[model samples]
Target chain A: QQQVKQSPQSLIVQKGGISIINCAYENTAFDYFPWYQQFPGKGPALLIAIRPDVSEKKEGRFTISFNKSAKQFSLHIMDSQPGDSATYFCAAVDTGFQKLVFGTGTRLLVSP
Target chain B: DTAVSQTPKYLVTQMGNDKSIKCEQNLGHDTMYWYKQDSKKFLKIMFSYNNKELIINETVPNRFSPKSPDKAHLNLHINSLELGDSAVYFCASSLRGESEAFFGQGTRLTVV
Candidate 1:
């Protein structure tokens, strides 16, 4: 199974709150997991990423929590701001295959 | 400078028409990919090229073909486009064996 399931197709959070999006993958061979943020009329950009070796990775206000055993990962945006309103996608890739599988995007709206 | 750039950001055509989307990456990456995002925001991989060689091809229709003349450029050609072919196509590039991939602004194709 190459699918990566993501929850909450849409999420609304208040500014200064926490925004969380979850994703789970079926392929155990996936060693790299990355989260991408896409704004209106823009391409998906790399927000943050995590590997199986680490349980979590934090970059600025964005953090990725990963669980190798559960084959799941999530993106946490602390102090959610209106500027963060956009579509977020979680992706997985097996370095050997180099095929990046993406989850159905989650549209996040941070209310001001 | 843009890392990954695709041409013709908006393409509108009728069914049975053939079209092409051009992509180029300036990151000197050895791998490039084409992804399709449907109306529901579900992203799927159609093709991937590494070192100007066809590597990963998903279960896409034969009407879709990808050509890479050089490592920095990857182009997608479609034949007999159908109504279902309407989607936003994205071009991405990454270094071999790396988890980070840069994406283009995407080409939105509308087939009527």
Candidate 2:
């Protein structure tokens, strides 16, 4: 199917806390998974990405946890800050068509 | 430099009018795409072009047309816009066979 399901349509976290967003896919053909961060009036920017070969990928304060067996993945933001408040989207891409199937989106808020 | 950019960030037009949105990517990617996000925040791929050639076209009304003169540029044209056409459209690009795709800020189209 062409769906990447995401959870917690909205989330609120205090500064210095941890924020997590989860996503799952039904298609096993997906090879690339990426997370995107978007601020109001801006396009979604690539935060971090991981392939099925690796279990996880970390970039600065953001980390992506991937599970090939469960067909699920998650994004973790360490030391949440107000500036980190934004909408996060998780997407999966199949190798054959290279078409991206995006999740419903999660609005994350980090309060200071 | 902006990897991807779209013109007229906000477009408010009346029904039955025709309008166009232009997109350009400085990333020198060989593939460009158009996606639409509705009120529910579901992002759906509408069109994709590689080397200025149309590769994929999802189910959409005939009123909508996509043109790409080259790999760096892709534009969308709409004729006889309807109320249901109101949505935020995003242009994105990536090098062929790559995972991450750069996205434009998005054009918010409101048809009244």
Calculate the i-RMS of every candidate, to one decimal place.
0.7, 1.0
TM-score of 1: 0.98
Q: What lDDT does candidate 1 reach at residue B99? A: 77
Output candidate 1 Cα RMSD.
0.8
lDDT per residue for candidate 1 within B1-112, as digits (tens), equals 9899999999999999999999999999999999999999888999999998999998999999999999999999999999999999999999988879899999999999
Off by over 4 Å in 1: none
CA deviation > 4 Å runs, candidate 2: none
Candidate 1: lDDT of A78?
A: 98
Evaluate candidate 1 and give its CAPRI docking class based on DockQ. Answer: high
Tens digits of per-residue lDDT, candidate 2, B54-73, equal: 88899999899999988899
As a whole number from 0 to 100, the lDDT of residue B13 in candidate 1 is 99
Provide the RMSD of all predictions against the true structure, rounded to 1 decimal: 0.8, 1.0
Q: Please list the C-alpha lDDT of all candidates, in the order they appear.
A: 0.94, 0.93
